[model samples]
Target: MKPFKSYVVRTNEENQVTHQVEEVTESFLGEGNTTIAVEYSSINYKDMLGLQTKGGVIRNYPMIPGIDLAGTIISSEDPSLSPGDPVLITGYKLGTEHTGGFSEVARVPSEWVVKLPENLSAKEAMMYGTAGFTAALSIAALEKNGMKVEDQPEILVTGATGGVGSVATQILRKLGYENITATIRKDYQEESAKEFGATKIWNITENESNGRPLNRREYKYVVDTVGGDLTADVLSKVDEYGSVAISGNAGGVKLNTTVLP
Candidate 1:
């Protein structure tokens, strides 16, 4: 109804990308069945790339960049939601192809809104955001693929200090898994990894491969947030009948390894 503040990223005719906080109206929110009072939003890797001129994360110019948001509904055409209902939205083209949550207000298709769990607050929801959701999804997928904690199976979480890995580790611990092994790129991350419930830490640089197509079986389950050579190497070390849930590709996209593992 009134002009509100929004952070906008625009590419000029010169192809230079710039971001600024500016005043906008409800019309700027674009089409949606629901209008929300945005309480919080979190920055993710995609959001960072969206600010770069050539990041390619943004499908169009003059966009908002946050990928995760949590807040209250102001109005909704969807009967399932009410004006004061607490809700959250992640993924689904928010902050990329759509007017996102980096504003005082956001409007999204009601189908995209998720009612916040009774125990979760908007701020807390944002604290978990997309990374935590991805981590939980990875673990759920691993469980669906036959990963179990009853035997105290060894679980490896790559990028243990990162957003997804850290959340994954804690969730595993909360689920009563004890043999959680975390992989990190630096020695300095050891303490933080352990704090996130890693029972052991493996430094990537220290674990050079022996050049074998397959290595000794180590972990029964792996949450691989880092891709590239690390994934190739780790796959060789997973035990027979093991499962690896690959998530992020912060390292690289290529997977150069044999199927023997």
Candidate 2:
């Protein structure tokens, strides 16, 4: 096999983190039953953290940092996968504890691979990478919990301009949802939120709270990508039998709320 270029992140003895693209061989890849010729990879929040020193994302030094990839198989020891097969990978130890998809070539366990849908190209698959996957999962969970588009329920998607929130908003709109409310931190993001199919744009104030255990029942469903006090506040606003799918903690981890809501 020929050498390929990869984005590598390394930490020094002084704990300084640095990253660069360098040529590497197949031997640099982690142990796996399959090798893929990576066509595309997408950046997620976790990928950013993986590039930072002690960011708590990467489990080892001298690592590649991409959580999602779409590509065609080059070779595989597993019979279930074969050369020329299109596939995508997300989650698992890829890009963290294992050599990830930032490389032109990637080796991952066969169990981590999913055949890409016929309608989706490798580039399109990566565009919906891990962030979009998370958003889709959140929406699926809400639907399973009784969310219905026919009811025209008010759905709130926090962090509306972010990858997950933006995808979720667009997905809901495509699913015929008409009452989507998207929250953004800045006024300027309203247009972007609207472009993502949000029927209403909410300007979220950091650490804003009404000091009550529960506020008015505003939304029937929530796809919260930002955690912390924002989640606490949203929790109080969810209607009875409604659902809130929490997928991130970009805001903070602490949630101070009563059990009433």
Candidate 3:
């Protein structure tokens, strides 16, 4: 059989990172229970990291950098998964530690695959990818933590213009949450946030930090896609018994806050 095309990332001994599209054979795929004909994949921040000189995301050299993929199963050794089945794979050290979705053909453990739901198409699933999945998962976690849309009408979403934040805002609105506050760093994103179902917009760059240990409670539930000090800020302002779901660390990874709030 002919080699399939794939985007490959390689790092040199001097820490120079190079990315290019190349043809690969099945032998390069390593071991897997399933082989998928990848139809869709999305470019994410992680993908950019893989192309950086010292991004530290790639565990090995000569890798494919895409965390999410949706496609039809070309073959499967696992009894549960069959050929021609539509499936989606995300996370689980995909782009970082393994041959990822940047290739026309992707092979992964069957355990890492999810049967594509009937309501969603392969392209649509890629549109959601890790970003949308994170949003939905964060909201689900909040709900599971006793958060109620009816009670917590004014929920907060940070990094509102981002992939996760935008999808989270829209999902909240669709779920009947009337008051969604989307916090953004840019002024121009306010209207876009509102269009994504945010009723209020808070510009993080324009807003001043009070530097207090705690602040008045404004929201019962908050989705903090951008973590670090921003997460600490959101946690401090959450109402008593309120829940905050933090899914990303784009801002920073460290959380510096008092135990009081």
Candidate of highest lDDT: 2
Candidate 2 runs further than 4 Å off: none
Error of 1 at 170 (Å): 1.5
Each prediction's TM-score against the native? 0.96, 0.97, 0.96
TM-score of 2: 0.97
lDDT (tens digit, per residue) of candidate 1 on 69-155: 998999999999999999999999999999898998999999899999999999998898899999999999999989877878899
User: In model 3, which runs have C-alpha deviations exceeding 4 angstroms?
Assistant: none
lDDT of 2 by residue, 1-261 (tens): 999999999988899899999999999888999999999999988899999887999878889888889999999999999899999999999999999989999999999999999999999999999999999999999999999988999999999899999999999999999999999888889999999999997787643677788889999999999999899999999999999999998899898888999
Q: Name the lDDT value of residue 169 in candidate 2.
A: 97
**Candidate 3: tens digits of C-alpha lDDT, residues 163-221:** 89999998889898988899988888888999999998888888756778789898889
CA lDDT for candidate 2: 0.93
Worst lDDT run of 10 residues, candidate 3, spans 145-154
Residue pairs with backbone overlap in model 1: none
> Which 10 consecutive positions of candidate 2 have the poorest summed lDDT?
202-211
Per-prediction CA RMSD (Å): 1.2, 1.3, 1.3
Compared to the true structure, candidate 1 yields what TM-score? 0.96
